[model samples]
Target: MTTKFGFTLMSIQEFETWIDARQLARTVLTIQEHHTYSPAYTQFNGSNHFALQQGMKNYHVNANGWSDIGQHFTTFPDGTIMTGRSLEKSPACVVGQNANAICIENLGNFDSGKDAMTPAHRDTIIRITAKLCKRFRLPVNTNSIVYHHWFDLSTGERNNGTKNNKTCPGTSFFGGNKVADCVANFLPLVTQAGAPAAPVISASAVLKYVSVTASSLNIRTKPNASSPKATDRDAAALGAILRVYKETNGWYKISGSQEHWVLGKYTTDVKRATVKADTLNARSGPGTTFQKLGSYTKGQELFIVKEQNGWCKVNMDDRWVSKDYLVFA
Candidate 1:
């Protein structure tokens, strides 16, 4: 393992261990696969890993005007994985479908007749993807692990590459980039890729759930701030719901088996719920008299931070909805 230019480079084995120890605040549902069309195999020389990664970050920040590198992780031709953007933030790789998603940019053009996939690189890609799916409790399905070519570039809709889609992940990525191709060629490898178990505690075991009120909350190994970070990138983003398993001093244990703890001061009580009504209005205050911000369709997920009378605050801010329309999860 090595660190350079604000990125941590690790082998496939190290990544599996590192991922299991992380205590992410946001719930992840999908894993996006992409190909770095610009920095092809020609640019790689078995070295210069940091230089290439830093170049992408500079382009994303300056030219693209994004806060940081778009992808959360990048896979090198040498089978090394380098960290990019924060795991807490939604990736900028996919346009309209970044929420609750993790993006992996394989470092190659990967188009037909361009950069034939190396054996080592292929192994890394497969293993890392399987590890992420296991870590996030996501199933190895088309909806969970997807190719960049599946989404429309203009509308960010999942049109399955019918139109307005770039051959991203490419025409020759793992044989092909189409949904059918993924089902036939790519997904099987990920599903069969051997991965260790990720223990998830049942809801009954959870003492309570809390919503992060602060913009970013640091996760510590012990109950005190003096303890080391629980993981390399250890802060949970705002609006992330944490399941508290144990309480010690002023800290809350956010993980089931890991020693990950966070300050109770930065969090507020919350409940997991799903919208039961056909359409539920989100208001500024607890009453219908308050201004309506937006509406949530049926089956939409939300965390209730505060409840007053028959209304529930859906978020940390003033967003409120009728508790009558919610089914507690």
Candidate 2:
């Protein structure tokens, strides 16, 4: 039989209710430990303390195998979630640390085999990680989330002093970490209101190109003129795909592509051929200024529907801009 940590789904109201129900006598982890992943019938590696103590590296056992508790949680191949060591209390998943971090043991050995991680596992990690981040007030993306390998990298230590054969989460699941990064990239900005100052992708990752040009560009907030604003943000390159949310005017309103501004002036070129060319230039009035507002290159993409007298109407990347701009590209 499998046990589940009983956590009620939390909303602001639900959180308040939980707070009202408790007098702060227990830790936060104890109050909300719902969600769990059960141990399935699978072969086990002798990576537990018992195996380590016996100088053996692999072993087989009952459904509830390990001699000592391992992992703060388990994510099944089927995507179910399970609890292990207390969330508030640290566990020994990463070596030399059991006081500050939580351990989640995912099944599979990507380091030595060709078996791939199931979609169920990837989805579970994403859901659970987001929940953990929300509960801890941590940023919800790659910048905040890290892999065990990252922990190892930052610590500058090897797992048990051996480097040749210690593959923990497997290579396939390592890719799952990238998936987590992608999720972290979009969630927060999507949940917020108003336009971002520029494309501010909360997380970092690769972006594909959709369009291109070669002139210097500005990122504005609203897609209108008389808004009278030009951001220091640049997006002037060829084939450069900076993570971005939307493009208005000739400028691209990028607030969800990266954590900061890459600007239109600095991009190199557009990479993809399918990307449609649509650049809105910053105009004086509705559409009288033959003068150029800004420019852009390939790999940058934006939508254009609003229009004013030969001028294309679009929003700016900055919040202060109240009007749109126009461009002829």
Candidate 3:
């Protein structure tokens, strides 16, 4: 294991042990898969992992204005897994759906006909995913493991990669980024990823999850915005998740014990739902005439943030799907 620039670089073997010993403070219901589209395979000459990681942190903190790197970890083409943001904090990867999630930024552009993934990189992705599943006691399915391509970029809703989505983790990633592709090509591998022991779960006291919509949400000492800022942390970056324990007068108690709170107006409630249809159309508007954005496959799960006209607005965005095909949980 290696540590540099406030990040830890570890081999897959080392990561397995490291993850097992961690005492994560928040619940992790899902694992996010992403790709560093810019620093594609071509940029990796094998010894620059630390430099690349620092560069990404610089971009996320300075350019994106995030509190830290957007992901919890980054998987490289050489199969190294480098730690980024704190595991205790929610990732800033997907909008609105980032709470209770762990993000993995794979170092490659896996778009169609681009960045032929190396064998080492491919193996690390699968193993890391499986290990996390086992560690979290999460079901090995599309809902628990997600691809960045499935969400709308602006609203952070899961519309199955409809319009306004970036083909992240790419279209050709592990066969493809489609939900069907995950069910067909990726999930089965995760199910068989490790020694097949019954998973041991670590419980969390989180009541529900909320995503910070405000570019920078203040962490108040009390439920109101007028309260002083928390001493430990000043702000919660947009797309970060807050583990809500209680609510009061448009404010949510984000900390379990302390008075850390944030205004509810800047955060949207998230609901997880599964598609009942073999293929459901996500539209630009609530009606059929709006525009067919994309199709969601049966059993695929996504986050819904709004409801209107018999349609569910996904991830607080313009993408809507017929409510007739949804089964909420």
Candidate 3 clashes between residue pairs 3 or more apart in a chain or in different chains: 157-315
TM-score of 2: 0.35
- State which candidate has the highest TM-score: 1
In terms of lDDT, model 3 sits at 0.81
Per-residue alpha-carbon lDDT of candidate 3 for residues 87-141, written as tens digits (9 for 90 to 100): 7677889875676689999998999999999999999999999999888777887
In candidate 2, what are the lDDT values of residues 18-63, reduced to their tens digit?
A: 3233211001111111111112224433223222212211221233
* 1 against 3, candidate with superior lDDT: 1
Candidates ranked, most accurate by lDDT first: 1, 3, 2
Q: For each candidate, give its TM-score against the true structure.
A: 0.74, 0.35, 0.66
- Those runs of model 3 whose alpha carbons end farther than 4 Å from true positions after fitting are 195-329
Model 1, 159-271: lDDT tens digits are: 67887898989899988999889988987888789632333434447788887778888988899999998665458887667879899987999877778899999998888
Candidate 2, residue 68: lDDT: 38
Sort every candidate by TM-score, greatest first: 1, 3, 2
- Clash count in backbone of candidate 1: 0
Q: Candidates 1 and 2: which is better by TM-score?
A: 1
Backbone clashes, each candidate: 0, 73, 1
